[model samples]
Target: MKILITGGTGLIGRRLTLLLQKKGHQVVYLSRKKENIKDVIVYKWDISAGYIEPEALENIDYIVHLAGAGIADKRWTEERKQEIIDSRIQPIVLLKKYLQEKNNSIKGFISASGISCYGTDTGEARLDEHSLFGDDFLAYCCKLWEEETRNFTPARRTASIRTGVVLSREGGALPKMMLPVKWGVGSSFGDGRQWMSWIHIDDICQLYLQCIEDENITGPFNAVAPAPIRNAAFVATAAKVLKRPFWAPAVPAFVLKLLLGEMSAVLLGGNYIINKRMAEELSFNYQYPELETALQDLLK
Candidate 1:
């Protein structure tokens, strides 16, 4: 099988590409410019200019869309918010237009979404994919991002992985999280009771692989682990894994709001997101379901 991956340089994309190649599948990347990516071919696409390298679409079996602006990378000013939405949406529109123009069809379309689709602060309510869309900025952004995936009617199967805090040493939230823990000043955000739905990096990549290969999996699937830990417990587990003390006081919500602006929701707010469809409906096996074990593997 040959696959085309957008945002292939990202932490998950890079790891997923290697896994695909190991399974005897060919992987190509869509980038802003054709660069020398080790052991893979990169094709250029300028979403702003509305041009995608024609050869990139040649004989592609599936598309794994991981391209997007980082949600927590900056303060959510009106400009940054638009950027976050457009970054995710424009790529989809471009792909759909190109595929339609060439009359090309792929077997599946896998997209990246956020667990914040159910809002940043949903308290302890156990939310599923069928739950109401979130009302916050993050939820609004994810809603728009997933809606754009509907354009790919050519792909027989379309699915969106509503991802959570992906734990890995390479990138994403874990490294930044581990820093304070390593220094023995680890603490939780806000009141420390907000739920932090998380998953191991390998599990998420495998989820993406399943979406590509399995015909039964479709629509939005929560990409979270079985156990959803509270913010304080989540921090405590990290401290234990790093062999450090977890005695620091929780960061006040107001301080985070002031420091991060609206982007504070990524840390100061959360939901009890359930991976029902992915775990029960799909029966997907998790490589690291326990938080402590997952942290130990990444931190050790």
Candidate 2:
């Protein structure tokens, strides 16, 4: 199988590319970087203007849409919010148009959606693929991202993975969370009862592979671990794994709001998302279903 990936240089995309290559599948990257990679083909594009290199979409059997400006990279000013949306939407629109114009045949389209689809704070209710969209900036972003992905016509087989917080040592939230713990200043955010749905980096990559190979899997699937954990427990476990003190008082909600502005909502609370479709419908077993095992593998 030949795959075309947008944002192929990003944290998740980089790992996904390597995984596909190891499986003996051909991977082509749709990127602005002109430098040649050893086994991968690089195609250039100007995302803002909605232009892509002609050859990027050629001979592509699958499309993995992961290009987007980091949602937490900047304070959620109105401008930053728009960039986040456009960065995701424009790339898909460009690819869709090209595919339609050339009448190319694509077997499957797998996209990266967020668990934030269920909202910033979901309490104890385990949200699923059929759950209603959360009313917030992140929810709005994921909605639009998946909307474009689902609209890729001529390719009916599409999988929009609503992912949880990815625990990766190389990038994502794990390192940042471990930073303060390493300094003995780590503590939970606010009351620390907020539920956090998470998945290991390896598990997430394997899930994406499952989506590709399983033609029966389609639509929005909650790509989270089997068990959901609270923020306090999450911090406590990280400290234990790193062999650090978990004695700091919980950080006040007001402090987070003041520090991160609208983005503080992500830290102040989160939802408990379930990967029901992955388990029941697809019968895909998770590589790391528990937090301790996943954290130990990454942190220890």
Candidate 3:
């Protein structure tokens, strides 16, 4: 299978590309910078103006859209919020338009979505496909992101993966969290009881592969581990793995609010998202099922 990926240079995209290649599938990357690489094609595009070189879509069997501004990149000023929203929406719109104009025979369209759509704070109720959208900025961003994908008229199949907090050693939330914990300053956020749904980076890549091969899977499937852990549990597990102290009291919510501003909602808020559909449909096995085990592997 031939796959084209946007944001192919990103954390998830970079890893996913390597996985697909190792499995003997062809991978093409869409990026602004041109670089020399083996066994992969590079197509350049300007995302802001919505222009992708016409040749980029040729003979592409699948599309994995992962381009977006990092939500936690900066304080969520109104302007930064708009950039986060546009960075996701515009790329999909451009690709949709390109697909429509070219009338390509693309087999599957897999785009990135997030569990944040369910809400910032979901308490103990495990969120699934039927969960209600959270009335928050992150929720609004994810809602629009999924809606854009729905507008595409691809020739074969379409899927939007509502991913969880990915556990990767290279980047994302894990490293930042580990830094403080390794220094013995780590503690839980807010009440330390909010649920956090997460997945191993390896499993996340495999879920995309499952989407490519399984025609039965579609719509918004939660790409998370089967077992969701509370924030306090996650902190305890991390402390155990680091051989650090977990006795620090939970960080006050007001302190987080003062530090993260509107973005603090992400730290203070969380969801107990379930990968019910992914498991039932694909029978996918997770490489890391428990928080402790996943943390151990990552910490190593």
Among residues 3 or more apart in sequence or in different chains, the pairs in candidate 3 whose N, CA or C atoms overlap within 3 Å are 120-270
**Model 3 TM-score (2 dp):** 0.96
Local accuracy of candidate 1 as per-residue lDDT tens digits, 183-250: 99999999999999999999999999888878877899999999999999989988887789999998
lDDT (10s digit) by residue, model 3, range 1-300: 899999888889989989999888999989887867777789889987778877899998999999899999899999999999999999888888888877766888899999999877777887788888888888999999998887767647788999899999989999987877898877889998888899999889999988887877678989898888888888888988888988878889999899889999889988888888877767888888888888888897
Query: Per-prediction RMSD in angstroms?
Result: 0.9, 1.1, 1.3
Candidate 1 has an lDDT of 0.90
Model 2, span 68-185: residue lDDT tens = 8887899999999999888888888888888888988699999998999778887888788888998888888999988888888857688898888998888989899989999988
Q: How many clashing residue pairs, candidate 3?
A: 1
Score every model by TM-score: 0.98, 0.97, 0.96
Sorted by TM-score (best first), the order is: 1, 2, 3
Winning candidate number (TM-score): 1
- Candidate 1 total steric clashes: 0
Off by over 4 Å in 2: none
Candidate 3 lDDT at 248 equals 76
